[model samples]
Target: MSSFKSYFSIIQVLLLFGYTGFFSCGAGAQQMASEVKEVKAPKLLFLNYTISKDTNGTYRATFINKVLTEGRLKDKTQRQPLSDAGDIVCIQYNDKNDVLDRSYIKNPLQPIVEYVNDDGNLEKRQLNLNSAQIAIKLQLQEATSSVRLFLIDASGNASTDLITTSIR
Candidate 1:
C-alpha cells in the first residue's frame, strides 16, 4: 500500500507540472503574436472635399477633412467656401520641399464626397473628375510622412488655405 501511494503522488506531481508548462507556452505564443501584429500601422487617413461650379464659371470648394487614428476618425471640420473663376490647382507639398501641382478646368467640376456608412465608418467617393490625381496625392503623402495641400484658383489665389494632413 505504501509503495502504491508513493507512485500515485509522483504521477500527480508530474501531471501538474506538465499542465502548467503547456498553458504557459500557449500564453507566451499569444503574447508574441500580439507583439508582431502591433508592428503594423493603420491603413488610411482620409480627407473629404467638395468642388462645385459657380455662376461666374469659377470653382467653389467646401470640405470636411479628418484623420484616422487607432481605427477612429478625428479632426473633422467644415471649411470655408472658395469661390473663384479660373483654372483650379491642387498642390501637395511636403516637409522636404517636394511639391506636386495639378491644374484642372473650372468647368465640369468634380465633387468628392465622404460620408459615414451604416457601421459608422468613414467612406469616400469621388464624382465627376478622374481619381488619378487624388490617388497620386495620397501616395505622395504616404511616402513623405506628412503633406500640406493647397487648392489654387485661376486668379493665382489659394481656394483653400494650406490644408494639411498626416498618415500613419
Candidate 2:
C-alpha cells in the first residue's frame, strides 16, 4: 500500500509538471509570434523561369520557378509540417520589371531547413546561402512579386541544383 501511494504521488507530480511546461511553452510561442510579427519582410519567396513566349508582339517572356513559404506563421520556424503545409514552392517576377531576367534573387527574412516532423510543426534549419528568384516583364506592364530561397551554404553549392531553375 505504501508503494502504491508513492507511485501515485509520482504520477501526480509528473502531471503537474507537464501542465506547467505546456502552458509555459504556449506563452513562449505567443510572445515569439508577437515579436516577429513586428518585423517587415516579404511573406512569399519563390524561383521563376521564363518559358516559351511570343516574340512577335514584343511580349516574349515565359518563366518557370519554385516558391517557398510558411503560411500564417510570422516566423518561418513556427510552421506546419512540409507535407501538411501548402505549397512551399512558388513562381514570381523580377524586381526591375524589365526583360524578365528569369534569374533574379531576393533576400529572405529568414532561412529554412528542409525537415520532416511527425509533431505537425514544420521544422526549419537555416541554410548558409539564402537566395530567391523572380521574373520581370517590361512591355505588358506585368511584374510578379519576389520569391526568396534559403541556401545552406554561403557559396550555395548544396543549393546549386535548386539554383538551376533560374537558368535559361
Query: Against the true structure, whose lDDT is highest?
Result: 1
Candidate 1's C-alpha runs over 4 A off are 1-42, 69-92, 100-168
For residues 1-168, could you state the per-residue lDDT of candidate 1 as single tens digits?
999999999999999999999999999999998888444453334455555545654444554564443442232221223445433444445556576423233323455589999999999975655222232213223344444445555576755543454533
Poorest stretch of ten by lDDT in candidate 2: 78-87
lDDT of 1 at 27: 100
Q: Estimate each model's TM-score.
A: 0.31, 0.25
Off by over 4 Å in 2: 38-168
RMSD, one per candidate, in order? 12.8, 20.3
Best by TM-score: 1
lDDT of 2 by residue, 11-95 (tens): 9999999999999999999999888755433334433543221334111223464545533323333122222111132223466
At residue 3, give the lDDT of candidate 2: 100
lDDT of 1: 0.50
